[model samples]
Target: MTHKAIAFFDLDGTLLDDKSQVRPEIKVAMTQLKENNVLPVIATGRTEVEVAAIMKEANIDSDIIMNGAFIRVDGTVIFSDLYDKNLIEEVYSAARENNDAISFYNEKEIWCNEHNKFLLGAYNFIHTPVPPVNPDGYLTKPVNMLLILGQDNDNYYASKFPQLNFYRNTPFSLDTVKKTVSKGIAVKILQEKLGLTKVPSYAFGDGPNDLALFEACDIKIAMGNAVASLKEQADFITKKNTEGGIVHALKHFELI
Candidate 1:
C-alpha cells in the first residue's frame, strides 16, 4: 500500500505571491496533488476572511488559520483555542494606552478597536480590506487572536501577559495567542483526527513563526526567500513563492 501524505503551507512568502495572488502554476500543482491523493492544507496566521479571498483565487479549502489558534477543515471548525476574557481585557488596555490599533478575530469576523494608518497599511500589505471597528463588541465574546499594529513594548507585554505568546509577523505588527497554541499543535491534532499518523506529513514555510511548523512535520521545506534560520532547518529548500516554489518543491519530491 502506498503512503498517503498531506502538504501544509504557510500563506505569505510561502504560497502567495508578492501581490498576494496565487499564481497559475501553484493552482496546477495543487490540483495534481489532489489527483495523486495528497491533500493540501493551508496553515497560516491569516484570518478566515483573509484566507477566503485567497482561496477564491487558489481554490482549496482545508485550513488551519489564525496561526493554529483556529482550525477549519472543509468549512467546518474542528478545533479552536480562544483567548481568556481577562487576557483580552488586559491586552486591550495595554494597546489602548500605547495608541496602538488592536484587531480581534473570531471564527466569523475580524473587528478592530480603531483602524489607523499602521493597521490599514498592514491589511493593505496582505491585500486584505480594512476590518470594521467595534470597540464595545470586543469584550462581549471570546476572541481567537489579536493583531497589534503600531508601537509595541514586547518586554512590558511579556511581563504583563505572561500566559500569552507573541509572534512578530512584521516589525510594526505582532500576533498574540495562548502560549500553548501553534501551527504544530494544530497539525498534530488534524493528523490524529484524520488518522494520518502513519503517513508522512509535510510543511512549507518562510519565517520565524514557521519554526514550530518545521518541528511538527516529517518533511520541512523552506522557500528560497525564507528567513536564513528557517532555511538552515529545512529538509528541502525550494524557490521563492513568486518563482513558483510550490511547483518546484512538489516536483522535486515527486508529489506531482
Candidate 2:
C-alpha cells in the first residue's frame, strides 16, 4: 500500500462499482490497504440505509455513509446528523406538486410514493435483495432527503421549488435535503472528533453533490464515468466503474 492515511471512497461509481459488487481485486486491495494503515471509509450519496444493505451484501464493513451524515462501525452510529421535519415537509410538498418522482431517504429506509424503476434496476444490477416493506423504519422518523426526478421540466421545478435545496445529481435525479447539510460539514465534524483533521485525506465521487467534499479534501478524484462538471473539479479522473476505476485509482496513488 502506498497512499498513506485514511482514504474516503464514494460507493456507487467509485468502490461498490457499476456492477454493484466490490470486485474481488478491490476488496483484496482494500484489505491490504487497511493492513498497511490506510483506512478506507465509504463516502457516498446513498442514504445510510442503502449503504448498510450494499455494504452488507458486499461483505465490506468499513464505511461512513449518508454522504457522511452518519459515521458508524459494525452497525453502531458513532456520529449522526438529522434534517428537520419542517424542511422535509416543504421538500415533500414541492415533490407532490411538481409531479416529479420522489425517493425520500431516512437513515433506515428509502421511501418512494411507489416502486421506482431505476432503483429496482439498481437493485437487480447489484443483486441486492429488495429492502423491507415497512416504511416506518426510516431515518429521522420521516425522511431526510427528498430524491426527485424532475420530468420534462427540471428548470421549472428548480425555479418553483428553490426553497428545497436541490443537488442536480446523477442524471435524471435531483437530491434535495436541507440546504445546510453536506458531506464536507459532516466529515469535518467527524474528522475533528477523531482527531483526524491533520491526517491526510482524499475523496472520490461522481456528482455535483460531491462538490463539498471535492473542495474540502486534499485529494479528490472523479470517476471517468462521472458527470462532466465533477470531472472538471476533480484533481484527477480515474477509470470508469466497470473498468476497475477504484483499483486503478488506488494503485495510482499507491494506496493498494
Candidate 3:
C-alpha cells in the first residue's frame, strides 16, 4: 500500500459479520481504500493462521494477529512476540489446579486434554482446530493467551499467577496472557512498522479484552451491543454487531 497513513481494523466484531464472513460494504470500502494506497491492517486477537486465511478469504493483503503476537504485512513479518516458556508451564499448571476447564493458544495450535469432552466441544463452537498435544497436555510452543472456563475459582488464578494478564469475557470464560501484550500494544507496533504517523487511530471492538486497545488509540468506538463498560469508554457508539456496527463506526470516522 505504501501510503501516508493506514487504518487498523479488528476482524471479529469490526470487519467480519456475525456469520464470520466479510460483509459486502466492508469488502467494497476496504478494496477502494487499498486502491487509494491507504493500507487496511487487520489487528485482532486471532493468530497468524486464522487471520491469514481470513485475509485471503477477504482478498486483503496485510494483518497483525494473536493480539499482536504474530504480525505480517503482505508477505513480511513486521514483528511477533512469543510467550515466555517458563510462564507457559506455570500458567498451565495453575489452570490445571482448577480442574480441566482451560485451553491454550500460541500462534499455531489450540490445545486441550482429551478428557474434557465438553470443553472440546467449545472448540467446535468457533470452528477453529484443536490438535492433540504430545502428552495430551500443554502445547509445545508457549501460548500467547489462556482461556479458562469456570466461575467460583475466579480469584484463584489471579492470586497465584499475579504476573500474568487475566480477565473475564463471561462468567464461564477467563482470558489470561503475559502482561505486556494486547491488541492496543499491537496497534502501535504495527503503526510504527508501517511508518504511519496518524494520531488517534480508529479502533472498534466489543469485549473487555479490547480495553487496552480502546484506551491506547486516539479514537475508540464500542459496538452498541458491547459490554457495559466498553460502551461507556467508547468515543462513539454505533449499531449492533449483527447490524454491521463496525461499518457504521467506520463511516462515522470517514474511513468507510
- lDDT for residue 236 in candidate 3, whole number 0-100: 93
Output the number of the lDDT-best candidate: 1
Among all windows of ten consecutive residues in candidate 1, which has the lowest summed lDDT?
A: 52-61
Candidate 1 has an lDDT of 0.86
Clashing pairs in 1: none
How much is the lDDT of residue 39 in candidate 3? 72
Tens digits of lDDT, candidate 2, 151-200: 45567666776654566645556666555567777667757766678878
lDDT of each: 0.86, 0.67, 0.68
* Inter-residue clash pairs, candidate 2: 2-254, 3-254, 107-139
**Can you write out model 3's per-residue Cα lDDT over 134-169, one digit (the tens) per residue?**
433454556666666566676787788777667664
Instruction: Point to the candidate with the largest TM-score.
Output: 1
**Which order, best to worst by lDDT?**
1, 3, 2
The CA lDDT at 66 in model 1 is: 88
Predict model 2's lDDT versus the native.
0.67
Sliding window of 10 residues with minimal summed lDDT for model 2: 131-140
